[model samples]
Target chain A: MRLSSGDSIFYDLFTAAALNLRDGVRVLSEALAPDADRAALVPRLKDIEHAGDEHTHDIVRRVNSGAKTPFHRDDIYRLAGGIDDVLDDVEAALDLMVLYRIKEMPTGIAAVVDVLDRAADLTAEAMPRLRTANELTKYWIEINRLENEADQTYRRLLAHIFSGEYDALTVHKLKDVIEILESAVDGFERVANIVEQIALKQ
Target chain B: MRLSSGDSIFYDLFTAAALNLRDGVRVLSEALAPDADRAALVPRLKDIEHAGDEHTHDIVRRVNSGAKTPFHRDDIYRLAGGIDDVLDDVEAALDLMVLYRIKEMPTGIAAVVDVLDRAADLTAEAMPRLRTANELTKYWIEINRLENEADQTYRRLLAHIFSGEYDALTVHKLKDVIEILESAVDGFERVANIVEQIALKQ
Candidate 1:
């Protein structure tokens, strides 16, 4: 399906929102425990969120004005929505890191961060596939698999944290980070779910 | 606007799914501590996951086969997807608790759980409100406020955790759980995001 200018524009907005979130996570990771400027970083995170909202509005307005939608209205809306979920996951993580003043990433936490990066990559990679429903099937499968990997990682990380290796406070901090990262993965998994359903329809 | 029989059925499927996920969370809260009978409880939890999938399949089937959707095709799909998200969020929390062998709830974690419960309730209550998009707006607002509250509590919890009252492992463990629960609130927050967006379109 050749998406109309409106659909393409909407995707661009979604992609931009996702990239901002990805960048936000990267910023958090780059900062050392004491030097993390969450104040500076969080505003940028909210920018991505607001961008998502604005784009959602654009999509809906155009949708109502009788613009030609490339796919079913439901598909376009869900894709837009899945993008919001992805961004929220990232923003939420940044919020926790800065608010808690989480100084250092625990040993297992870095792994979850890696997982978030990979999932973000998948999300980025999946965008072009949305132009054609046929291409979506393979990307959809891969995203699902990546999400499964995230699940396994989340499980292993939780196990290690609870192994009583770290102190109680360390346990709390690391767990907060892990949970946020895992939710981001869940966001990716959800995108996969919507795509799979869309693929069947296509 | 009168809802079609198909629409009613579709909504019921999601209602059942949300209830299942909500119950799953309660089950997890009880089972999370070290004393949980994993041998029996794990299977039951797995059952909840399976049941959720079954509902997802049912939704997909109905969408694929049906011609006239009760509401807009997009609304039906969004409703279905949102319901799935509720389950996914709950399942992730439960799975992590079990995997980590987290014996008991950390103090901050309870606050996060309360937020999640509130969000879930908002979603459940808002479902019928879709019949009147105006009421849905109220649900949207409340859920957003709750997410904000959860956000505040989360930040406070993290600050306290980092305030250095506990040891390293305690910090680590509580951090993980609190973040998970926070993200769970964010999950409901995400749903609220969707409903609010929908209301905006209306």
Candidate 2:
């Protein structure tokens, strides 16, 4: 997809935001590892999230400056905001893990992180094509599917938590972490949905 | 604020959505009552949520038709989606209560519902001003503050739940309901944020 001169900056911003999301989720996956070091990994995750915030601010500044954007200015704003949301939730999940002083990851946390990793990868791959709105249908469809899978996983994990397998406190801690991870996956779906909306308009 | 012809439909849709959100949360509050009849209230809440879905669809249809919108079209879409999200989370919370066959509401559910009710009223009152962007700073600021309150309540509720006050199963069920209610409040905050963003851009 060939980008016009005016649209190139948006493409750059979106791509950077997507790559930042990928990095943030990678850190998240590491944080959910069985032997993960919360103290060490959390600061690194925060850095990635901070980087995502900077990219989001750049996109928002561009939109607010009344520049000629490739798509509707609001879509660009939403896309940036949605990507930032994914990173924010990633950071939140990691922070919760640290705050709760959870020594062990829940059984389903890894699966949720795996889905987020794929969603982030797909989002990065799909973002550059936003200039032309090309092949976005598959991107969004796959994202939607992954989100559904994440939802099921979330429900199953909740059931497991409540199934008398763990004490009330442990269940509480794990639930907090799982819900944040679920929100991150949902955040990715929101970005995909926004991209699909923009593509349809284009 | 007198609405221009091009903006009137949007105002109508936004007002209807805000009202629907109010109604949905009202029902949600009732559902959290100690002697509530889940069977009776769930259907009514679902009706209110369905009505919200209709209003949201109307907004999207209008935007998709390239009709002249009062604000940026993307803002309209996001505002509609954010409003619908509040109602959807309300409905989901109610559904979870029924599905979990929860006999008692959590301690903090009422507090969260009160905040949501106030937030909904503020949002409804603010929708008309969206045309002129009048008096909106207070609206979003108050909503943000309410969201903060909801967050504190959520944390406190979690602490209470995990403080060995309830059995594992009961805590799990209550936590699910509380989280969805929290999300509804957050959804309201998202709407307020979008409104603030639109107001600033204007």
Candidate 3:
């Protein structure tokens, strides 16, 4: 697939967004460490999230300027928005952790973060391939599988929270964080789904 | 602003999706009623959700077949998916109610449902204007305001639930349902957001 200059720019933006997502999820996983500095890590996650926002804005701006898009204009917008959403949820989870003053990290939180980090890595790797639609199926499939694992982990965490194991306040604090983590995973799946749809259309 | 034949089909799909959303939210609100038959309402909600899914699928299939879409292809896909997502969450909320066997409805539940019903109605009213992009600013703005109201209601409900007002199990059940209702509202905002983006690009 011969790429035009505008297509090259779109690919660059998508790649940048993916790398930002991967870095953001990595920070998120690290922040979940039991001994990690919650205060410091959150600001870094915010920077990554802001970068994601800029990338999404850039893509939308380019699309609006009537640049010749490599894929359907709508796919480019969705792909950019979808990638931004994953980062947004990542930032939200970290912010909630800080707001809730969660001290100890739950084992299940680490598990879900691990899945999200891998999904982020997969997404970053898959973004460039949007041009060629090459070998994208495995990326979307893996993301879907990771999301299912995250779902199961989320349910288990919910059950654990409500099993009289934690105080009401603790449950209240933990529930929002866990749900946002699950939403981040779901956001990744949405990005992968969009990629798959683009591939199928191609 | 004249729409071609193919454009009319896209409008019809969006309208149908919006109507399905309105009906699904209505049923969801009714199911939350204290005297309602939860089991029967579940299947009916399921049917509405299925209808939403089919409409979304139809839009995607049409887009895939190279039909001339009124908006950007990505916007159409996002709009259809966003509308379908609200119904999906509505169904999820009802299913959780049944799964958790929540016999009593909280007062806050009805308030959020009322907001969602209006949001859904607003969405149906806005879909036709995709052709002209007429008066959509008000639509998106109103949806955003409704979402903000829903957010305040959600936080208040959360505070009430965690104030030792309900048992831990009850809190667990209500939390998921309320969150999904909030999510449905957010989903509507997303649809409006996509519409606004499309209008801007025009």
For candidate 3, write residues A1-202 as lDDT tens digits.
2344746788878898899889999998888999989899987998888888888898899899988887899989888888888888888888888888899867777789789878988998998888788889889889889998888788778767766677878878888898888898899999998999888878
Ranking by lDDT: 2, 3, 1
What lDDT is reached at residue A74 by model 2? 83
Q: Is candidate 1 or candidate 3 better by DockQ?
A: 1
lDDT of 2 at B170: 92
Against the native chain B, each candidate's TM-score is 0.80, 0.95, 0.95
Error of 3 at B96 (Å): 4.0
Give one digit per residue, the lDDT tens place, for model 1 in A104-196. 665556666666677677667666565565566666677777778878878888888778887666666677777877877788788778767
> Which candidate would rank higher by TM-score, 1 or 2?
2
After superposing candidate 1 on the true structure, give the runs of residues whose Cα lies further than 4 Å from its correct spot.
A1-14, A28-39, A64-66, B1-150, B161-202
TM-score of chain A of each: 0.80, 0.95, 0.95
User: Where does the lowest 10-residue lDDT sum fall in candidate 2 chain B?
Assistant: B1-10
DockQ of each: 0.42, 0.22, 0.17
What lDDT score belongs to each candidate, Candidate 1 first? 0.68, 0.86, 0.85
| Tens-digit per-residue lDDT, B92-180, candidate 3 | 88877776567886887778988988998999999888778899999999999999999999999999999998887687778878888
**lDDT comparing candidate 3 with the true structure:** 0.85
Which window of ten consecutive residues has the lowest lDDT sum in model 3 chain B?
B1-10
Model 3 chain A is weakest, by summed lDDT over 10 consecutive residues, at A1-10
Best model per DockQ: 1
How would you class the docking of model 2?
incorrect
